[model samples]
Target: MSESLATDTAKPLNGRLAPPRTARVVGLGHRLPDRVVPNGPIAERIGVDADWIVRRTGIRERRYAAPDERTSELATAAARRALQDARLKPADIDLVLVATMTPDELTPNTAPLVAEALGIGAGAYDVGSACTGWLAALSIGASQIETGRADAVLVIGAEILSRVIDPGDKRTAMIFGDGAGAVVLSADGEGSIGPIVLASDGGMGDAIIASHEDRIIHMDGHTTFNKAVKVLVESTQQACERAGVTLDDIDLFVYHQANGRILRSVGEKLELGDERVADYVAETGNTSAASLPLTLSLLREDGRLRPGQRLVLAAVGAGFTWGAGVVEWGLK
Candidate 1:
C-alpha cells in the first residue's frame, strides 16, 4: 500500500528491475439464488413491521441459497460466467482466488473445490477478510499479475450469510443475504486497475463477530456504522490520491453495501450526489464479501458502467479490515 501513483513493480535477484506490468479487469459475473426473501417475513420474526425493516436498512428483499446449494457451487457458477465473458477457457487461468467467510466446510478450503468444479488445475486459495474479502483478493490477484507471476487470475467473492445469521437475532438476521460474484483479471489489456489501499484495526474485531460457541453472527450496529463510514471515506480518498486523481475524477463510488443509511451518510460527508454514489443495498441487503462485485455486475446489466469510466471501490468488514482501489473500466 504505497502512497504513490505508480504500478506495483518487482525486482529480480540479479539486481535488475522487471518491467512494470498492469492487471486489467477483462470480465465480470454474478449469481443470486432463485428464492427471494422479502423483509416481511424477516421483520415478523424479529418483532418488527416490514416498513420498519425497510426504514432501518432500506432492504426490501434478499436472495437465499437453497438447502442443497453451497458456497462453492455459487462461486463455481459465477466463475464460469466470468470465464465465458472473458472468452477464456479453464486452462487460461494461472490462479484462482476465492474471498469467502462462509465456506462449505471447516477443513477443506473453498477455492480448491471451485477450481475442481471449473475443471481448472490452477493453484487456488482463499481470502477470509469478511466483507472486505473481495477487494483484498482483488489486490492480491492484481499484484500477482503485475509482478509477472500469473497472466490471468480469477477473483471471486462469495458468501452464504444466511447460514451464519441467527434467525432470532434482529441485528444480524435483517441485514444479510446470499450470493456470489467474480471477475477475470489478465495482463492482456492496458493498466485499467490502479493502486489499492488496505488497512485494518484488530482491536475493533468485536464490533462484528460470530462466536465459535454459538456459530451465529453478532454485531454492534452503532460501532460498525460509525467506523465503517469513517474508514470508507478515508480509504477512498487514499486510493484516489495514490492513483493521482481526485474524487471528482471518479465516475462512480461503489462502497460496500452494508446499510443504506451508512451509504447516505458517506455520500453526504463526501458531498457527492445520488447519481455518483451506488445504492444496491436496497435490493441485495448486505451480501458481505459479495457486495462489491455483485453491485458491479448489476450496474453493468443496467448499462450504468462504461468502458472508459473510472470507478472507486471501498469496503470495511468484520475484522475491522478495510481497503479501497481505483479501476479504469476496461471490460468490453
Candidate 2:
C-alpha cells in the first residue's frame, strides 16, 4: 500500500508541513503460559461437557499462568522476544507501553516492571482498555514515533485473567487465558502504519465489568455480540476509507480474538471470507489485551503474514472501546 493513496488528511494539515515520519512495526512476538487448560477440565468444573464449550465458544483449550507468574513476567518475556526479533537491544528502546487490564499490582503500573526486568531505561506506562489495549497502544505508539517524540517504542499487551475470573462462573472461566504479546515500532521512511480509527461508547460500559469485590469478569453475551459486531464493522470500514483503500485490498483481517461468533459475524458483515480472517481464539481463548498482537505473532510464525501486504486490524473492548487501523506489513 502506497502512502499516496491515503487521505490528504493523513498528510500534514498545512502546506508548509514537514514530511511525516512513518511508524512501522519492526518486530512481533507473543508468550502464552505453560499450563494448557483443556475444555474438558473447564467444562467439568462448570457442569458442562467438553463438546459444549467447543460448540458454544469455539474454544478447545486456553493457557493459564502458574500461581507465581504475573502479568509483568509474561510481558517481559514477550518484550525480550520482540527485541530479539527486531535484532535490537533493550537499551535501544525509547519508550515502553503496556496494555493490560489485569496488572500484578494496582499502583506502579506493569509497564515499568516489564521495563525494569528488560533493563529498559525509558519511559514506561500502562494502557487499560480491556481487550482493545493493543490497538489503542499501537495508535499511541505510532503517534509518538511519527511526531518525533520517540524513535523506537515497545508496545505490549499482557494479561493474567485467570487470577481475576471466578472459576465457578462458566461464562468467564471458559473464555479467558493468560498471555502477552509485544511489537517493536520504529521510525521508517517507506513503511507505514496509519488510518487508525478509534471510538468509545461509555453508555454500554456495563455490558462487561469486573465484580466489585472479586474483580471477576461479568458479561452479558447477547448485548456484547450486537455492540461488538456493529462497532467492529464500522471501524474497519472507516479505517479503510481513511487509508483510501477498499476492503478488497486488505490481504488479511486481524480482528480482536474475543469470541468466535463475533469474529464470524464481523467477517460476514465485511463480506470477507473465512480465509481472510485470522482465528486464534480456538487455541488461546480470549487473552484480552493480548489478542491482536498474539494473533499477529501466530500469523507470522505460520508464514501467513508477508512483507508488503496490506492488513486491517480491528477490535472491540469492554469499555465499549473499539478501533481499526490499516498497516503496510514491513517485517520479514
Candidate 3:
C-alpha cells in the first residue's frame, strides 16, 4: 500500500463534505475468453431467430470460457495487466477484493485464489452483489483508502456465467457471458473517486435467482427489466447529486452492460445523447459483476477514457442490489 497522510479533508463539493483522503484509479484491465458464442446458435436452441436475440437484448455475441477455465484465472490475468498498467507490483497491493457471484467454489471464495496466482500476500475477500458487484467493491476499496485503512487496493469483478446458465433457457442463455476486469486504486492527495450510493430491495430478490435445486440462473425478464431501468436512472441521478455535479458535467455514463434496450431506455429517461452513454452489451452480453469494469476497459482501450474526465458508474443486480458512483478519471 502506498503511504499518505489522511488528516486533511478534501474540499467540499456542492456543500458535501468530501472524504479526507480519496482513492484514484491508477490502472485498469479486462480479459474475455477466446470462444465467441454468436446468437445464431443460441437462437436455434431457444427457438428464436438471431435477429430476435439482437432485437430483444441488443447482444449479437458473447464470450464463453473454456471448459477448463476457472474464474480465478481470468481474474488473475486481468489483475496482472492492471498492475503493469499502474507500474506497480503485486507487493504494493494491501488488499484484494474480488466481486463475483460465481466463485471457483463456495468454500474458499475467489479473491484468495486470485491473490495467490498474482503472488500477492494481501488480505483478500469476495463481494457478491451480482451485477452491481464491481461498483460495490469499488466503494469498499475507496472507503478503505479514505479512512487510511489501506493505501493501495486491487478491486476485481469476474464472472463465469456460462457455467451457471441453462443453455436452453433463453432468459439467461442469451444474456450472459464470461469475463473479468480489474482496477488498481491508490490514495491520492485529492479525492478522484466520489460518493457511491448503494441500495437494494430484497423483496424483489426473486426477480433474479439461481436456486440450489438446479444451480442455474432464472430471471423474470419483464420484472427485472422494469426495475433495472428505474433504479439505474435514479441511482445515476443520486450519484451525480452527491458528487456536486449535474448530468451535463459527466464526460461518460457507464452503466451495467445488462441489455442494450435497458441502456437505451435509461438514456432516454436521463435525456442523454447516444454518444454520452456506453452500450457494450452488444459485444460482451451481460457479464453480471464483470459488466461495468469490462466496459471500462473497453472504453480505455478505445481511447474514450482520459485523465480528468468525470464519469458516472451504475448497476442493478440480483438481491435486488443496485449502486451508482462518480469518478474523475486519473490514469494517464
Best by lDDT: 3
Alpha-carbon RMSD to native, per candidate: 3.7, 2.4, 3.4
Q: Which residue runs of candidate 3 sit more than 4 Å off their true CA positions? A: 1-16, 189-191
Model 3, 161-255: lDDT tens per residue? 99999999978789999999999999853337888999999999998999878889999999999999999999999998877678988889999
TM-score of each: 0.94, 0.95, 0.96
Candidate 1 runs further than 4 Å off? 1-19
Each candidate's lDDT (Cα)?
0.89, 0.88, 0.90
lDDT of 1 at 134: 97
User: Cα RMSD (Å) between model 3 and the true structure?
Assistant: 3.4
TM-score-based ranking:
3, 2, 1
TM-score top scorer:
3
Q: For residues 278-300, could you state the per-residue lDDT of candidate 2 as single tens digits? A: 99899999999999999999999
Residue-level lDDT tens digits of model 1 in 30-56? 999989999988889989999998888
lDDT rank, highest first? 3, 1, 2
